[model samples]
Target: EQVKVSKQNFLLGRGERLTDDIVIKGGGGPKEPPYTFGEARRRLSPMVSETSSRIDELPQAACPGDEAVISLTINPEYVAKSFFPHELMRDVGIEVIGSRPKKTVPEKRSRGREPSEVFTTELFARGRRAAIRNWSQQLPDWRSDRGSANALISIEEISAPVPHAKIKGSLPEQGRMALETVLHASELEFSMIQAFAAYLESQGIEADLGHSFFAKGLCFLELDAPVERADDIALFTGVRTLRQMPSLRILRPTVRSADIPTTDLELPTEGPVSEDVRVAIFDGGVPENHALTQWTSRLELPGMLPATEGFLSHGVGVTSAALFGHIDTKVPLPRPYANIDHYRVLDEAPGQDPHKLYEILGRIEGVLSSQEYDFINLSLGPCLPIEDDDVHAWTAVLDDRLSRVSTLAMIAVGNGGEGDSILGLDRVQVPSDCVNALAIGACDTPGKDWQRAPYSSKGPGRSPGLVKPDLVDFGGEFSRPFVVVAPDATPSLTTTGGTSFAAPSVLRLGTGIRAHFGSNLNHLAIRTLLVHTCEEGDQDHKENHKEIGWGRVARSLDDIILCDDDTVRVVYQGEISPAKYIRAAIPVPADPMSGMVTIKATICYKTQTDPHHPGNYTQAGLEVTFRPNDSKYSRNNQVHPNSASFFGSSLPGATEDELRRDAWKWENCLHAVQRKRGSSLINPCFDIHYNARLEGRNFAPPESLSYAMVVSIHAKGVADLYDQVVRQYATQIEPLRPVLEMPIRT
Candidate 1:
């Protein structure tokens, strides 16, 4: 058979071998291996020299000291190159501040042409004038290295900052506009707030600085101005100034309360509180006199004011749901098993000042770092929707804290899913987009009829596309909302619906899992178990995925961990090192009548991150593969016989680069496959391979990265499959049994 290979394939480092039984109908012919491989290699050898000469001959320009930021378009071949591209920047005194995948538009199909792929990264360098000038002169050499070694495609100066539409749109007609701006930490010495204020004054625009945030090398500044002068202020502080400062990143509108429908509700008084699980709820202050008050230990954190009547309902309802499963009086339930600690972070008023809300980041950090709690439930978030290109300060802070702690936090995905706004679909609000936190969305009801609530947030998440609403829970439908305690002192019940209620329901489930597994179980293991047991309904449909995530979580911990006859579940909890592989073998039944075998697995891990680099946020990623131990299922015969690697390449004809570009680098990943029983395997054993990689800078490849893997095998019409496997490989396989803890009898 004749094989045709393109020059681009040679450039991408994929043309080294020609596999069996394939006909490539183009340039190369079979029986000419030396000629085919030799010709391509010869053509690729002179690329560097040619590129270097061309770069040196091109025009040169001196870069200003203030405008030291440059964006590099890396060649797609950079990953396969011998040298890391970032090292080139370092040699020239350039600092690779942050990087994100460059967005590409698919080209229209044309005859005899393949789509092109380009990788772009941004670099920032700061030094004295002489150093800046010297580095600028080395541009040609940098370009030469990039072109020859396939490290970079092009280098260009980043001259301006982009204006945020939300900031401009939120400006008032006459009064001053309130703006929240995040400046790069490197530029803080410039005193950006003062510079901007002075600039505004020169334009006869009065400006007030309200708050400043300093964390993770970020400087958040709050500015207020009259509505009429807002546009002028925006113009003066726009892209041109960003070019000069190189550190100011984004300017957004401060969030304010929007009218949401609310009705008062009475607290549930039927359940007794057990001290088995400890959870902290951060929101408005909880009233000490509520019906569930005896079950909770209330503490108002310093800097938080007392809760008022208007702000009491939200906190009361969320706390009630977290402590007691559901607020409906008709649903009979046992005494609550989880203890509660309520921390008031929000003010008692109906609405919060945006500046004050921004200040809450520090308070949250303090509580998360110092407080002792097994689980944290956050029913609050900003009104602003998360941006694909930017990681909000709130989300970054929360993710950083969660990664460092053993405890897991659950955040509401927000109730902004209603209306015609694009944010209503596939745009989970900030903090909820925190990749480390389990962001919960609202389901319309409980049990089999559960659907995504109209007011529940949806998400493909921000860039890198971490699927949001990791799990959904009953938050109540429009017509059948969850009942809650009213704001008034009297005992009364009101119906309401939002993701705020849904988060606690999931937290309640986490508490149960914690109770069974004990506090020793890592958060990743618990997260894996919860996602492993999620019930998928209409999830195969692509649209429903963004709306419901992995689908609604199981109601009980036993339902999640325990397996019935004919099904075997295995759980692996361990850590993986960079560039190393962890393998697990599963013993399969050898019976011809083993029936259909279905395999489902969930992998969850926590990763360190460069919060400033929204484009390349997560620092570590897990690549997983599941396949039969049989050697016959080689790469040539099967599309993805090697299992679903980090890029999910098990599907037919998917290329490595294609999968790598689409893989989710977030902390949580899930994949499942089902196959009918057949006699193709010589060995009835299956293997799982886990590989870990350190994807960004400043991340010390941990000696071992902790992770959890849950695998379940089910057979149809084969009642003895579980017994057969357990008996055959008793030492290698073990059933996942819930640790039963007896309830205290009252």
Candidate 2:
């Protein structure tokens, strides 16, 4: 077919032909003759112009491939004038303002060719460098592919504004058309934006652009002007989809500030002596140079070893409180007890192997065997809501091994704060969370009052629950009296708050109790002794509640285990007053099968020699006990056994209704006292219990032969004190009293 070659058919960069027949022809105009260089004057000679021409008169032959090469040159001034078309510039919201004079390049010529040449140049910009390069790579492929069917195009560079002058590539054919389309769209969007900006600016409002993926399809017009102006513009725009630009958050370094007041809680009487009593503080080890080193004189500690790291300082602080607590006015901290031992685990690696805990147990056991330590204080732990199987296995091992050991272990409930998670009171934290461990909770310090440290982890153990934080003690706080270092000294001290501090205080009390009450101490007995010696308070007294573990803490060693003859007589000491009636539970023995026993009572007080010491006398007193009967004794003359029965009945003879009546009777007594004295008393009850081991189904090992006897004295009077009474007798009373195989007839 003889295809008519149309002048309008334009060839693409890639070998492709466009069918569009739209080409402009040059008009044939008057011609001028070529001037001879020798005939013309030099000034009048035409400037030498470079042009491509065939060297031979023969017509140009076709090359193999279907591609055409065209030559062209652009005036630098023309490109500078339209550098960034107004439409494209407005998209970025930058004004063209003006441009610098164009620098012209000398005209060039190639042998038998025109001066123009095509080459690719890379584009880049700071921050936007990646985006520009990415765009550039896509250009050639995109232009060639699309231009094959549209307008063929090429890219170029031009001078730019700001940060040195440089321009990106441009398109000559199809590319130019595509770029123009983009520019046109940007111009339309910018026009709307400018009109809105001007409207806002006139009302004293300014707007800026911000990215917002969540704005859906809507564009973000940030309120940069002012809050009121921005709000006005936003409301005025009727653009409900607009959102305020997020503000950048400011972050600044933090510096801790602390101020501690001097305390005068020291007693004139020398500290009650405690010797080679090994009390192991399980926590971060104290650096010898610490300000708290001064109190080393008072602690009954073993060799110091490191605990876990990261949060190790907490353990260090606890150790200081437990083993080396001494307060001095000018010195801030007085000399510490030189003999105390310390075990540290300052490595704070998370999820540490708990076997280390077992090793620590072994160390405590060694100390116990050597008769070096009387008690061990464990202030570090991996507290838990419920014991993990692994933890239970270890605990069972600890209970078995420790049940036979003599040293006392006092563990701290963690300081996870009273959060609903790990440390919540409902979740008893561990080693303190361990069944046999004497878990300690934090109390207000200085006056040694009851108030949970804000951070103390609390708990309601296993369902139906077991009591936790077996005891409470002063942790530390500004409101409480504590000895701390002055801020401006070469070495300074400050009061810190945490359960870490409280564990030590209770340890001191336990060690002091152990020292006062001679050897043969069992876990139950020690637990009982501490529980019996506590000074009880209301919910306001301790962190969680009155039921938070044991709601008492020992204030004086004599409160429990008073030296009487060959026996150390124990007591459950509590606050007593005229405003409230006090009731106590004393242990008595009875056959669980028979379920019958009689309760006996006594009332007396130590005679007051001096009017000064109020503790020497008591107007209200009672000794209520359940005395067990020996099976061999004849009915009438049966001498009571000093143990209590915890089974068969909730209360042996009292009907539910009768029990209620008795409760009312106790209340009446309290009311009568309050009415007479014009103030009800907040009685701290001192209930007492005693025990003896016999051949029974629930036999414990020799070390655990004795059970705990719990004596509870309360303002409201006694209620179901049997379990605690049994624990007390099993732990405290039995360990102290001699056990005979059979009853003796005198």
Candidate 3:
């Protein structure tokens, strides 16, 4: 057979870090303000008094000396650590243990205000109850005495953790629950929590830390106690949120669907797949001796894991999807993209086990801590939906683990879109909110006519990670079910429909991309490329971002890597020091061109997280500024050039929320396109500045961050643009070619 040539996009490191400054300089900025001391005291005194009074009438009584959690809402502007009310808290003898960013809609909207514009992240402090009553009685005078320290004037409100912070709905008087305690990991705090647990044990209530994990500086643990007891536990200064653990609430564990017609499918011919690529599926246990054995192996824990029929079946289907994709009944089954190791993380009583969330995560974490994989797909997570004011243990631990290694994880956004949206039950589930991983949602079908599957979760995920279900792929629908290998010993197929299958299907594609492009394209670059070449079709103009996100993944590998005649795509993979700026120039033809040109770019990076700060979850952010012409200067600022809209601009006629500091600026996956006349372009480039924060406040020193960018330029009537770019930047950039045979599927 004649070998066909392939045109490949290239990588570049043309931008270099700064070595020396032409001139020495120092800089400072004017500070943003909050409320004045007197007004703030006047507004907060009543709240404190009411809370002080209310605390006495609670299910649990708080002795003046007993530790209690009091929430102090602060002015939005004073969120930085420097602006924290530390001095005042010390004066009042109350220690501020922890804080999370919050956004509240002003009761009254101004004439031009949208919710996003009207709300910026405000700080809600967890204060250890100390002299709060005395402080309330003389609130106005104490802050005044400190004069400059009255920065506590930022206090907007004081209350017992608000009603919304607690577990919602009713639960049996004695039921199993999970308690999230606000502890910042100190010997003193740990002792307090241990003592509380001991007290609970004395009462015969179970408060085990065996399966516990920390989130947002809070410890979440399994507890078996009465509803009244749960309420009393909330009184402790360390506890923040509580939830009723569901019984047998397994998600996607049952592969429910219409039975498929008998079909013949062949397993991939056993041979060495690209040794460079590694993939894994963290799900229920797959059936023993399944036909997928050629390319799939189970990572069994120390002992034999117990499994139910449903779990095994669901596991087989999920692993099958990762290996074979939505099996095509029309043609012969294709070879597996890359050999995958399936970890039987979930066993027989996962859903029935209240502490299963932690156990499952522990298993997954243990595997990640040892073996490394290039790609991983998780089709299951907690049945609970994500919350704005909180971070779940599963999400925090997984995100932290992923950040330390070079791995691309895909999470099913969940199959709860049909749930009640008004109550947010229909939103993306926990762990998928992870800023470091791709949260996959299912579209109804595999064709261009597809829409988000009715059961696939939706999302306007929490800000800073607003875009959710990173990309959609065909999971399956009742009308058109997804076919996968069954749990039967012999090669067989079954029908299913859910986001569980959608996630691995996409992972299969990623591994295939890695197999084709070789190691030159790391996981981050592959992520950037997948998101960059997304096909939105009519969705490009839809207001369904909350549902479809960046739109569906291109089904075929060719669509993603192959470029059009007038288009040229380049990938930038590098690291930048914290608080420094780097330029990523948009590749274009050498000569001045005519007609209109469109530039589409997607930038992706992983961040070390602060689970304690849901409002400021990601510790790193990139402030990308697009400057189209080097010679043009803004009239207001002479030193820097003029800038134009790129990633952060709102769509036409869109009433986008004005988030405090613009949440989009910190989003990990940023995709946007702009069309302009070719003549206006003159060395256009994006200036990216990395911003670092810790515990919702600036840090003294920051670490370097890794980032990948996929930018493509398409010029009308410029048939030779790709050739021109390749020739002009010959020394700087080269094509990313296949290191092995490219798989062919028709």
Model 3 global lDDT (CA atoms, 0 to 1)? 0.72
- In terms of TM-score, the best-performing candidate is 3
* Candidate with better TM-score, 1 vs 3: 3
Q: Model 3, 562-649: lDDT tens per residue? A: 7776888887888878777777667777677789989888899998887766777888888788888878885865765778979887
- Locate the minimum summed-lDDT window of 10 residues in model 2: 667-676
Candidate 3: list runs displaced more than 4 Å.
Answer: 1-35, 46-67, 77-95, 101-138, 142-150, 162-165, 173-189, 199-210, 247-263, 540-542, 651-660, 743-746
lDDT against the true structure, each candidate: 0.56, 0.34, 0.72
Model 3: which residue pairs collide?
Answer: 116-657, 116-658, 117-657, 117-658, 182-238, 216-611, 216-612
Q: What are the RMSD figures for all models against the true structure?
A: 11.6, 38.8, 4.0
Error of 1 at 258 (Å): 22
Order candidates by lDDT, high to low.
3, 1, 2
Across 1-746, the per-residue lDDT of candidate 1 in tens digits comes to 76653111000001101111221122223211111223322432344234333333321221123322333434332322122455545554555554445544222112334656433334333333344455444543443324322322223223222233224223434654456655555344456455566666676777677766554544556666565654444443211111101111111101222323334333335443345566888877678776667677777777666666544667777876776655655544445657788877766332335556665666777788786567898877666566655666677778878877777789888776764465343367778887777889988877676788887777767544357878898887656667655544665556666788789888888887676556445577777777778887774465776788777989765576556666766666765555454455544566554445677667677766565666566766664544454555555756334442322543212235535554453444554555645443224332323333333443345466677666666777677666776676565544433344444333
* lDDT (Cα, 0-100) at 611 in candidate 1: 59
